[model samples]
Target: MEHHIYIIPISTEKLEMTEDNHSMTNEFILIGFTDHPDMKTLLFVVFFGIYLVTMVGNLGLVALIYMERRLQTPMYIFLGNLALMDSCCSSAITPKMLQNFFSEDRRISLYECMAQFYFLCLAETTDCFLLAAMAYDRYVAICRPLQYHTLMSKTLCIQMTTGAYIAGHLHSIVQVGLLLRLTFCRSHQINHFFCDVLPLYRLSCVDPYINELMILILSGFVQIFSVTVVLISYFYILFTIFTMKSKEGRGKGLSTCASHFLSVSIFYGSLLFMYIRPNSFNEDDKDIPVAIFYTLVIPLLNPFIYSLRNKEVINVIKKL
Candidate 1:
């Protein structure tokens, strides 16, 4: 038998690095919509239009809320925060996605990918709790109109908003920290457009058991908690509305709740569909369109949903 020896060269820097450390040189190839190369231009145009509309609509809403004195109520305050978060959430992913459409190099560095993932998570998590807060606000306003001012005071509103932001940061920190521990040795092609949690975890060479569990438990808790609050609030609101003797009062109350319910339904529906399941569901490319709807289309549609249904916003716009 002949003896064979194979010498594999290793860089000195790599040898010194620990298993937990990810190499800066590692790049992820986002194979986003590349299979439909023929539709690249069309997709670009469509997403670009969506991005433009999202920016103008969200920022415009924020500005309108700020400039108009009558719009400075607690409800409008929450609306402004939602607009800001929506703008940030869409911005964190859309610009890079648009660039990927035209660029031959779809490679994203490890740091950039992580940064994108972090901000996206922050905005999303914050929005979850923010929606809950908004629901609670509505509950107080509708169910206990006399006590609404006392229950949702300026101080309480600020505290709730602060808590939402803090919760978002903490959630992202834990998630991103877990993700950084895993090493990626397999192919770098991320099937999705952006650096989503499931796609990144699937690409890891390790078992990713802990990461997946954390996602399931933490994300499920947030989703369930938020949805519970919204449901409970709406239940009380509907009860209170029906008890009212005046038809005009009932119609007005329903009108307000309808817009909020619509917004909440659209947002939470897309989110749950994308994230409520295991990583096995991520393998399907069909999820990409759903992800786009969650991240981009929802943000774009939010302004229209709220503004079209809201006479206050319309009055403000007319005054401008």
Candidate 2:
């Protein structure tokens, strides 16, 4: 009697186990600045403070927008949504990240990771759409002031906000769904603070070509299309502002856009740097700072950026 032996590849074994959801690693150790143990306390304090302020600032703006009858316009509605999404973005990341700073066991379960990434994705994606919507609002207000009210109707504003959320939901769902197909077997240690998709790809035993391609296509399209809208709208706005006979009109136009543009530039710049590149996987050092900027700092800054420069928000605050 002759016996034949067949050996399965280790990668294949890992993939099979992962598919069953009982892989060797059901939890990932988030190696977030753990190397810098001396700085942990300071970092935690700083981030905690930032997180508290971010929540207060963003939610306060939302509340103010809701309460103020004069702020029932299209611009404030978009600003309110932006503030809400910022709060979501900060809340999704900062708590877990802060927890990890002191946690002896910084392991996060698969589902927790998914939830974190989902909310973060949703917030960021919706933010892109919201910014674009705000740009279009500015364009209509500045370029075609005569038709502003007619063009940016309440129904249209609601539809645009609804569309942004719907797109965000779909994008997050698809991305998380794709993550399920990946088999993380190489190492269970996530290099960054959270369960970011790119870091997970680095640990996958299977080729993540499809996942990467989808990110490039979907995220690329979202960023590019939204950015195009912003740029074109701003171009038209600039043309109109410069062509205006009244210095007051030009000043008003620039004032109205300054805050939104600053916010958009910082938000999109960080995003573009983080995701829209081929060698992103190799950029660990650069990634952390950029991620912090977008996920934490941007949210912290946005409320102040929009509010301090605006006459209406200041008046509302004074009345409060």
TM-score of each: 0.91, 0.93
Q: Candidate 1, after superposition: displacement of residue 87 in Å?
A: 0.6
Query: Between which residue pairs do clashes occur in model 1?
Result: none
Q: What would the per-residue lDDT of candidate 2 be over residues 1-320, giving only the tens digit for each residue?
A: 99999996678877886775564467898997988999999999999999999999999999999998999899999999999999999998999999999889998998999999999999999999999999999999999989999999999999999999999999999999999998787879888998888899889998999999999999999999999999999999999999999999899999999999999999999999899866996567677888889999999999999999999899889999
Q: List the residue pairs that clash in candidate 2.
A: none
| Ten-residue stretch with the least lDDT total in model 1 | 18-27
| lDDT per model vs. reference | 0.88, 0.93
Which residues of candidate 2, in runs, are more than 4 Å off? 1-24
Please tell me which predicted candidate would have the highest TM-score against the true structure.
2
**Candidate No. with top lDDT:** 2
Q: Candidate 1: lDDT over CA atoms?
A: 0.88
